[model samples]
Target: MSSALEVGDIFRRHGPAYVHAHDGHLGRVERRVMSAIELCRTAALGGHIEGCQACGTVRVAYNSCRNRHCPKCQGAAARDWLEARAGDLLPVPYFHVVFTLPAEIASIAFQNKTIVYAILFRTAAETLRLVAADPKHLGAGIGLIAVLHSWGQTLSYHPHLHCIVPGGGPSSDGTRWIACRPNFFLPFRVLSRLFRRLFLQALRTAFEAGQLQFFGDIAERADPQAFARLLTSAGRQDWVVYAKPPFGGPEQVLAYLSRYTHRVAIANSRLVSIADGKVTFRWRDYRHGRRPRAMTLEVGEFIRRFLLHTVPDGFHRIRHYGFLANGQRAARLAACRVMLAAQVPKAEGRAEPMAKVAPTPRPCPCCGRPMVTIAIWYHGQAPPGGPFWNDST
Candidate 1:
């Protein structure tokens, strides 16, 4: 019925649209985020670009866009991010818990953004902590990390959190560490019910506190009665609470976390066909066999979908709580690492494995010594046709 869309057409139209729309409003905070995305790995960002002096193998000095949202820049970020976390991992089987918001709540989230999203994180974390503390499960305090992913494989807004936690936690007295059974984790049904109730309760609180702003299709819910109705409907629905089996060990958990943290909506290589102003890309249909599937959308529609993931200003998508709290974390982590290492057998000789760093390409226009990093370039300040993230004034 309508004309098809090409990937190129979509890119040509909306590729720079975000750049323009994001102007000045990004301000100081957003500029820092954009700088990490644009300046990463470009000569304009300035780096010690390596080049062979004799063979004329040249490399251009570059920087990296450290933006968590940039597809091209996330690999290195994940690697480095994992490295920092590796030291804190315990020598035990860790579980992966996924908490997903219902479609109705997701719709509301799209309208309110900052307020709803923050509540989503807090409520979910609270649910996990409360349920895990119950004597029926493992009556211990679990330390975990939660990362919020707001996009599905097709760049659609699907807000969810990926939580990696030790199967067991330390007891209330802090004397003996409790461990969950190797095979089974918490019951999903119980977790889901508790999660639903807690989330709704928190949502109602936010509404009364005037933290949530209703607009557009969601304006009807401004009335407390309407909002209560929406919550009731959502609460009855099966809120997704998926728990993955325990990982092999600490390294396995950290490796898995690397994939979810600092990821963009989609990778460039996954982009396949762009035809007639429509764009097609690969996606994994999780409802099925996790099979690879292709989806097509119009150029304008695609951009609209993509832009939905731009987070509210200064809101943290990745958060640590419980034992992972920022205050006294370093000291607590060091103590935990020491306690765990005492149980495991000592290493034979070599050091722990290192996460891989991305290879930075050097393009030497002037075949001389490796250019040293002098400065960095952010998005707005980038000169026309210059490095996207270079720090050229």
Candidate 2:
């Protein structure tokens, strides 16, 4: 057994049996996720050789899978994403808002992930922008960075969107910036009501368009009447839209985004041990004051829960909307700065909070110097014979 336990370890050990057993249920995305995690950073994918610049040490470095769902690859991905987003930050308070799907809706969402998740993003962003633009509210065009999280602390399928929104934005005419009160952004009740209405309406549209599919227990939802009943039930309930306190500044916002943007279902550090066909891992019970606790699950169950969060290929989990929309983000942000009367930012100082954005390379074990890539190899090619280096830090 490896000294450090990883989700990949469980997958590599029992993935074959799990895959065979669940062959009827698993989709291509989940199967690919399992295979990628199992083979990540292994010579099976092929990598390159690296040598120390200071010392004459040589080592074999394997390639990373680079799959978004792979736990080992998110750290570097987060760093790169943060570096790009750093310049887009505005000089204002930022709020963290979460929009969650109710359990009833979440059940439907699980079956129609791509459509429902897209609805979640769209409705959540629309809710924020609509509410902010109301004259009764901030009455400004707001920008937000929305990230989709499909798992809870216990790796359960709990879908939610975490949105980092600037406290204010340019007015309708772009003449001046409209800033919200220092402590308040928008009314939660108004946002919740609108979000619920928008999502159920969108779900109905998708259903009518023959875009939603159902199977197994939910197969009956394929019936128009049955689906309408589900939506009606979901509509009656109050949706949850929570806004956290304002961030201190752009630095804190960058720090916060760095953590949530590229997160996977679970990190390898949470694993305690795997034995007796059971996997032990740490989690926080949020209901109980976030007290630390450990839960043990059968290895197969663990793998299933982890794989449940694999998103569809080519689907973006992180998105920008309103003023931050990728197409007009640069121009809109420039206008916002000018309206706010903030100093023009220099290239070097744009993302000072992310000064450490570059990931530190794994140092040579023998001399503690950064290893330099000496040679590269393609997949299915034989690598130079040497000790396989553990590139993880």
Top-TM-score structure, candidate number:
2
lDDT of 1: 0.71
Residue 372 local lDDT, model 2: 82
Q: RMSD of each candidate?
A: 6.4, 4.1
Residue-level lDDT tens digits of model 2 in 1-393: 344998888998999999999999999999999999999998889998887767678888789999999989999899889888888888788999999999978888888898999999999999899999998998999999999999999999999999999889988888999998988999999999999999899989999999998988789989999988998888899898998888977888988988899999999989999999999899999899999999999999999899889898888999999999999888998898888776847442334434654567779999898988878888788776654444552
Task: Give the true-structure RMSD of model 1.
Answer: 6.4
- Return the TM-score for each candidate structure: 0.80, 0.92
- Residue 375 local lDDT, model 1: 37
- At residue 110, give the lDDT of candidate 1: 80
Which candidate leads in lDDT?
2
Q: What lDDT tens digits, residue by residue, belong to model 1 across residues 1-393? A: 223323223444555665576564334543454445444555555454344544444344455555666666778778777777776666777788999998889988887778888888888788888888999887977777888888888888999888887777667876667788877778889889998898899888988998888877789999999988998888779999998877877767766887788877776677776667677788999889899998988765666676677777778888887777778676765555554453455352211546656766443456644433333445345523323233332
Task: Quote the lDDT for 166 in model 1.
Answer: 72
Q: Stretches of candidate 1 above 4 Å error?
A: 1-13, 16-51, 334-343, 346-393
- What is the RMSD, in Å, between candidate 2 and the native fold over all Cα? 4.1
